[model samples]
Target chain A: MYGGGYIHDDQKKKPEMQAEDPVLLAEFEARIARGEKIEPRDWMPADYRRQLIRMIEQHAHSEIIGALPEGTWITRAPGFRRKLALMAKVQDEVGHAQLLYSAAETLGKSREDMINDLINGKSKYSNVFNYPAKTWADVAVIGFLIDAAAIVNQVANSKGSYGPYCRALERICYEESFHLKQGHSVFVYLATGTPTQRAMVQDALNRWWQPIMHFFGPSDKMSQHTETLMRWKVKMASNDDMRQQFLSMYVPKIWEIGLTLPDPNLKKNPETNQWEFTEPDWNEFYEVIKGNGPCNAERLAVRRASEERGAWVRAALKRADQHYVTPLA
Target chain B: MNIQSLDPRITRLGIDAEEKNPDQTLQREEHWETYQVFHQKKRGEKHSSVGVVHAPNAEMALLFAKEQYARRGETVNLWIVNTRDVLAMNYDDYDVFSTTPEKMYRDPAGYKVNDKIAAYKKAQLDV
Candidate 1:
């Protein structure tokens, strides 16, 4: 999955990258303008490398942390089919983490450092995952809606200018399509089931609606650095555009399934061909990202506990002949 | 899920019951062998390297690879090769990969066919 679509301005320490040659920078920009992908070995502006490392590292962190909520439901899934499907689905999320981490690693950060930053709360992930998946139906909502939103972002980013990231997203988007089907099937099953089941799903949808709205993030007009990011293809679609796309595509589908959205202002504008909705509570979004959300502490604690528990596994995998070498900055 | 362990000497849990058994050390899932995955999209297509999966055996490797690499109807066949078994030439010997002579003629572009074909078509049309 993708991050919450935030390009954070405040990383604790920004690398003091030296100025790139203006001619080289111009050439690089022209290459991007010409739609040429920048490979790992290519010379780049320091800001580009710094921005991509943050963006892709956050994406990778989101995938693994994103796995936790759904991963918890793997065993408790209602039946054999669901259990197996969820297992594969959650496993795919972890695999996406591996793919994304490798892609980010090509930018020069080790997966270990990324994880360390994640564990220490020095980096960020999608804010949606900080919320709890309280029930089985929450799984259905998250799997379907969250995965759908991610596909929207990923499909756009797959065409981005970074070669390894684009290649990885190509594969990731392919897998996510199948994940969408599984998620949609589960959502349909729960939605069309008995009255109790229907209510269960509806409640889950209500709980998740705000988070889903917050998923694309606060409107792009609120973002300041987006213009340059867009030029570089690092931020492919603006937050508003992606939100509009998701609403246009999925709002009708949700209604067709006999589910109602919690939003009173949600409607499509005929003249503008845009979705008009109540602005999501950006205050709550900020609160969640600042470690004040209902599940943020718990999520990070669980991650810390998991790393401690899994230390032996990683240790056992280390070769006896090799010493640990830290990755380049 | 209640299946027995495949090893005859081990208990159903796949652990030796004897306290002194050397195999009773830390049992971590990381010990699983790495398998390189190659996927063929169609019957006649060439198999291409997709990625890798870690599994205890070949069967498990194939099973893991299906959902990991082939879940989206992306492949008709998959090959899982244990990573340890792969032999490789060092990059220091990268010189061996190229021949000293240029092979420009290997490409049809070498034949300078565009001018010839255009002139021939032009001549035919003129006639």
Candidate 2:
């Protein structure tokens, strides 16, 4: 649920290297064509491994980073019920990170390297979390709207080719469904409770609207060529399509609840059956990815401090002479 | 990371985990391998993997998982399974696990007994 649609497409394709083994590549591709899931020991093209690693590493990074914005509110949650639920939700996010990191490890990258890359600003996460959560109502908006958006993405990705990640996501999506319910409950309380409470929720939604739209990334016309990735089931659904699907499903629900979207242009087109809306600013998205967002510095600083503080415990618990057992699918 | 892959002597380098010795043997790899956590909320129920935990050993993993996952629930039994010990086949072989559509023979719905039952009732009434 932590992932967004902004896929970083910077992996340089080595056509020559992959072309060296056409027969094996064809066999690998044939398996994929037959709706076969790829295992860690499966004979896949080098680029496939690289692309999967990059995507999964980014996803794992997003889960942990995404926790930061929500984790801050645990202590400030209004009541015991809200506090307990928020703490569990945040812990679930961190557990997802742990699961995702393991799934990525099946591709050969260690969790340490991924964290280092994230902390050193050499990697990316979801663009939405860079914005600050300015109010308690922001928590509601994140829990309901943001989580709803992630379900759309993760449910699609759960049918992906990688066995480990798909399994991890299957469990994750189950937990997220409960999260959505919890979030919806909180949102309904705010939206229907009091005049001030209603205003707070509306104001929070207004602020979060742009980031939510940007969550799905740029348009398909502006997208990178993903034909091969799609055929391989690496990229399950396109960003624009996911965005359209999210809007069609959630916009009416928002209105039915007596809340409104910030974008007036957000509506479904009858003829094309596409939801039409003003595109979010890709320039700001790219800028935020470059580490200039409102909370990026603070986020990384906190992560750095945590790693240092937890170093001793990790050291004290270290063991030697281990065996690498193949993980279950 | 699996510490078993390292030579046993590697532990002698120092307590400092960040030791950057020139010899590769002295290097330490941080991050524990993932262990899947399963909890049975009540006795006699099947255990299900609720989440994952990372720790140096299985005992520690169980403890960590108990604290992180079991606190909010009524857990009666907890199981910590190393992801490595779980053997997963390729998803291309997924048909082995599917029991839908063509597998109606395994369910009571597969039987069509309405007509037979009606004939049996009529025969009984006549007798």
i-RMS for every candidate (Å) is 12.4, 12.5
Q: In the order shown, what is each candidate's alpha-carbon RMSD?
A: 8.3, 8.6
Off by over 4 Å in 2: A11-17, A221-225, A322-329, B1-28, B34-52, B67-76, B81-127
* Candidate 2 lDDT, B10-30, residue by residue in tens: 222223433222222111356
Winning candidate number (DockQ): 2
Evaluate residue A305 in candidate 2 and report its C-alpha lDDT on the 0 to 100 scale: 49
Q: Write the per-residue lDDT of candidate 1 for residues A1-329, one digit (tens) a residue.
A: 55556655464565554678989989889989999898766788888888999888888888888887787676678999998988888887888987776678667765666777777777888988888787889889988999999999998998898988887888888778878898889899999999999999999999999999999887767345567778888989988889899999899989998899999999999999999999889999988888788766655655665565676766665555433221111
Clashing pairs in 2: A37-B92, A321-B4, A322-B3, A322-B4, A327-B84, A328-B86, A329-B88
lDDT of 1 by residue, B27-48 (tens): 2333344567889999999998
> In candidate 2, how many Å is residue A311 off?
0.7
